[model samples]
Target: MDEIKFICECCGKEHESWPAITYNSPSSYSNLSDQEKEEIAVIDSDFCVIKHSDQVDRFIRCVLIQKVNDHCEDLEYGFWVSLSEQSFENYLENFDNENHETQYFGWLSNYIPQYQFTNSIPTTVVTKNGNERPEIFPHQDFDHPFVKDYYNGITKEEAEKRIKKILKN
Candidate 1:
């Protein structure tokens, strides 16, 4: 396979290597209307919040690494998840704390292509004691094919194919 590259919009730098997929926002945010997004949603590279008349949906950016069967490179995803207000606040408060460590229950907010479901999936978002983004793990008992593939892994050819398809010319 050829090298995959993407220009980082966040840092305005070139990224030679790449994750299999990276989503800019949660599907919920994407579903909002233009005026709704401007009036009710606050989003950045790491966090997002959508305010509804009766509820506030909070989200955070996270990474999920998927093992590709018989492949040297794993399939990684930069996805989003909905968090409770408390969890979102805590994460935001400790954003600059390199030693902060915690965990939160979240709902997978991105409708990944292969794992598209009617409802958001349950997950555990783990914050590490460093600069790295939080990692999410799907609930093992969740009856979803995506969760199964996440644990069992995908074929190398499938992984490469997905990447090539995503980063099209």
Candidate 2:
């Protein structure tokens, strides 16, 4: 397969090649009951809904491996945002139509603290919403001082230290 290269708008670096995956079929989300949906309904895209929870710990570990192995290249601040169940459904219903120029809102399902970047960073993704390739934006609030600082930049050593701490605890 030919490598896809592009200058990333997020990090301002050339992406030699990277795999972009999109899940259009909401089979996983659709299978959940209303109660489960309520339990996991992400209200804020800026921060992790599961932060400080065991789930976050596990997620961080998995993300670390993925960053080290899959996204080893110059990552746009090290993490990418995903859409929440409700937000994704809304996007599919509204934007996957004839109109392809408008922007849609979605919640972040994945958050990496070690990445030191919040939701403010926007990027385009190919979605099922019309074959025209509608872009989905992840809205994040950077009101918190810490959130802003994370986006500033973290040294690789600091990131590794944080990851070790998360793993050790």
Candidate 3:
């Protein structure tokens, strides 16, 4: 992992090292107005919830590893996915159990700027033991550039460009 650093918006505290490129919240939650957020949405490092128009949307923060074909280090993203109500409930129910492991269908809920039209890829969310955050895998048949990239991998220079684009550094 490279020495990527950022200050937290909430605490204004500097973090020393961030191994994976990260997104703080799902795009759906970020899209809500301040008022709507105040009334209906809540998020932390691992989960997010929004209630609006009489429907509830739940999201979980997950990791996606993207291969960098020419580099020793792979690019990783801390992204989110929207879960079905039952799936969401199942996840929440086992949130604290280190022994729990399962999989659920999800929709990718964040934007990856390197690729246009990157959101809402059909995904499988995998929960691992020891209570780590879930990981997501894009469905193979999803006909999109992002999906292709996920499987085919990117060049090291392309990977660095993406990191710079995200970090603005």
RMSD list, candidates in order? 6.1, 11.2, 7.2
Poorly placed runs, candidate 3 (over 4 Å):
1-18
lDDT by residue for model 2 (105-145), tens: 33333434444434444333434334444333232253543
Poorest stretch of ten by lDDT in candidate 2: 57-66
Q: Candidate 1 vs. truth: CA RMSD?
A: 6.1
Model 1, range 12-92, lDDT digits (tens) per residue?
A: 777565455888999989999999999999999999999999999999999999887774557889999999889999999
**Model 3 agreement with the true structure over 29-74: per-residue lDDT tens digits:** 8898999899999898888999888799999999999998875567
Each candidate structure's TM-score, on Cα atoms with residue i matched to residue i, is 0.87, 0.30, 0.87
Error of 1 at 128 (Å): 1.1
Error of 3 at 50 (Å): 0.7
Q: Pick the candidate with the highest lDDT.
A: 3
Clashing pairs in 1: none
CA lDDT, every model vs. true structure: 0.87, 0.38, 0.87
The residue-level lDDT of candidate 1 at 86 comes to: 90
